[model samples]
Target: MLTRRTALLGATLALPAQAQERFPSRPVTLIVPGAPGGGGDFTARLLAEGLAGPLGQSVPVENRTGGSGNVAASFVARAAPDGYTLLLAYSGTHVANPALFRELAWHPIRSFAPVALLLTAPHVLVIRPDLPARDMAELAAYIRRNPGRVTYASSGVASIQHLGGAMLAQALGTEMVHVPYRGAGPAMSDIIAGRVDMIITTPPAVMGQIQTGAVRAIVQTGRARHPMLPNLPTTAEAGLPGFELEAWFGIYAPAGTPREAVLRLSRDIQGVTETAEFRRKAQEAGTYVTFLGPEELAAFTATELTRWSGIIQGLGIRLD
Candidate 1:
């Protein structure tokens, strides 16, 4: 009886080893750090679809919204270092959060191993139609001419839109008051009413406003103009060299995840991003593909983390 009981315990312990050898013997879960219907959620679902076939398993998306994404980041950080569990992270997770969340438990570099950097979404430089500015030069002139009177609206404090405004001010060698709204809706409404001088936010956030002629999209900070905003010139084309503000999207797994699994996932994800269908869908979704492998993602994140940390500090923007 003793021998039989000992053999049963040994078999139980070997089960996990056998499963680990197979890598993903079951479905994988991709956790998004935002509510459903958000940009991150949309990208996560799209990526999940592309991954399922290649992974030989279903990749389900799970929304873990709250705590300004720390909730999801910490959850993934604590998850087993296996390929089965992954994170679909936003640029703010590293670039903005580190400076804001002083007590952030998960270090972007230490807590997770980057699988791939998938896309970069650009922001639009929009202003109320009543403003005399119609282009980057004109806008800069208007902003400079107005001095501290010009105002920029954002979804909230420390949001990408807010940072973009600050960057714009810095690039133009001027200052614009930051007006934070509870969300983008209020910001849009006020901007339409000419209550705010400008707003730098995602293309989607201002696409309709631009179309309806409520807001003038003078320039967009993308390599190429968005299909929906063909007339909008990119920063480079607008004669604003090196003045680009974009949100990056990437995938990560818990640190200590097997290198083999990381490489495998990265290669497959690269393949996914390269597909014609994926490209079409991603562009339509306002996410421009810019794939980077594990090492590249790690290095890029580190550089961005440093740059944004200083920028945040200089701006004196802090959030809980």
Candidate 2:
């Protein structure tokens, strides 16, 4: 009787292992926590396309936009703990939203499992071409000279763009009133029309305008220059040191997922991101591919949350 019981227990444990080994038995759904045609949507779609062949499953992306990405994040937290449902979590969804929303249904670290880091994009300090300030130094001087007269736009309050702009102001010791918009597209439009004095926007959103000379990209908020915009100087290089902030996106699965399943998914995503096609697409989107493994990705998420919390508190921003 004892030997038979031992055999049954071993079989039960081995069954889970075997199931994990053969991951993605069916179609995988990648959830994008933003509207279609935006960075999160585009990135999720590309990841789905890039992961299909390697993972031996059809990866379909679904957009769920609301509450500044909290809606989709909450949905993912309640999803089945299988590898089929995955989340494309960006800075706003994973880090800032938790602090910004008073009643966020899911905890970023506790409610979901981190798979891998996808991409990191630096925000560009952009202004209308007609603005007199030509570079960061000039912009800083102008803002100090005309405090409260200039307004900066961001996609939303507590967003990376918002924190980036606030951090810049704190470092430069100047005051530039913030104007929050529903999204980056509308904010960029207002900046182009001269409705907003300047904006801290993503490179992908404002790259076309910068190329056309409609908006002047004075500097990028990163530690080093991006390959796509090598000529553009970093914010630290321009004047303010320690002013490096980049928007990052990663993949997550619902918590309590099988450990082996999470490892398998992470390996697959790392492989897909390192592929030539994925790299090319990422570069074209004005971002660099940096896939962090499980432990590193979790640590990075914690750091990002802390960084944004400080900025939000300092700026006295509250979405609630």
Candidate 3:
């Protein structure tokens, strides 16, 4: 008889299937939680271009910079879980922020659906050329000699760079002053000018300085040596065993987004990442494109969250 209650129930039951079938009927927005030209923005734009062809819709990148990625993250977290809106999440937003902040507007793991891991860039430890520390061992000795006097710069408070430096100091059983900057440019400039003793950042940010001899590469925070800086040994090899920190970028949809939509996006993104052109582009940017589907990404995110939360809590880091 098609009563009102029955009609409502039928419509409600049909929504998931209908939404999945007509998913992304319009343009999709990939939110970047950083200023344009930054690593997150670049990764978002690259993925948007690659995804448009596969998704059959224009994927546009929207930059919503603030609160160390909190602004955009909160926006996406509160967005409808319909797959049209997505986030280009990184270690800062998901792993570090959850540990650093007491009250984040969104849950790093629970508020979003993991789609895929797009790329990873190993953090490099760069120091002023005149610091006199030729290797990690020498650097450790130097820090020990002048404990608590050395200053390390980071893009901002609670950033991945800050966490990396904090972790290194903890491992070395020494203390160093942390200097927060507005952005990486100013921080890198200070490091080059010898105002800051060192900075732990990604390769692309400091590769030019290292190449021009303006700064020295002490060690990388990766399990393996970075191909671009083959001469630089990893922290594990350079005395800090088992210390590895690599910044990763991945895609995420708001939680409750249909499973079909999540899987479809992950599959297409995996294809995009495998293309030769995309690989070359990512390499040239000092990042490597690697694909991990939804389940693997979820597992990876869980592990990272647990790992960084402990590190951050142990270091007593907080950001309101």
lDDT tens per residue, model 3, 19-52: 4467668898999876554567778888888889
Runs with alpha carbons beyond 4 Å of true place in candidate 2: 1-22
Candidate 2 structure quality by residue, lDDT tens digits, 118-174: 988887889977889888889889888987778888766666777777777777777
Model 1 per-residue lDDT at 13: 79
| Candidate 3 Cα errors over 4 Å, as ranges | 1-21, 182-186
* Ranking according to lDDT, highest score first: 3, 1, 2
Task: List per-prediction Cα lDDT, in the order shown.
Answer: 0.82, 0.82, 0.85
> Could you tell me how far off, in angstroms, the CA of residue 202 lies in candidate 3 after the best superposition?
2.2
lDDT of 2: 0.82
Top lDDT prediction, candidate number: 3
TM-scores, each model vs. reference:
0.77, 0.85, 0.84
What CA RMSD would candidate 3 show? 4.3
lDDT of 1 by residue, 1-320 (tens): 56998998888778867454776678889998765544566678888889888888899999886666778889999999988899998775556888987688799999999999988888888899899987888888888998889999876566677888888888888888999765455688888999998888766456667777999989989778888678779999988888878888899999999998899899989999999988988876666889999999999999999988987898777886
Q: For candidate 3, which ten residues in a row score worst on lDDT?
A: 15-24
Candidate 2 colliding pairs: none
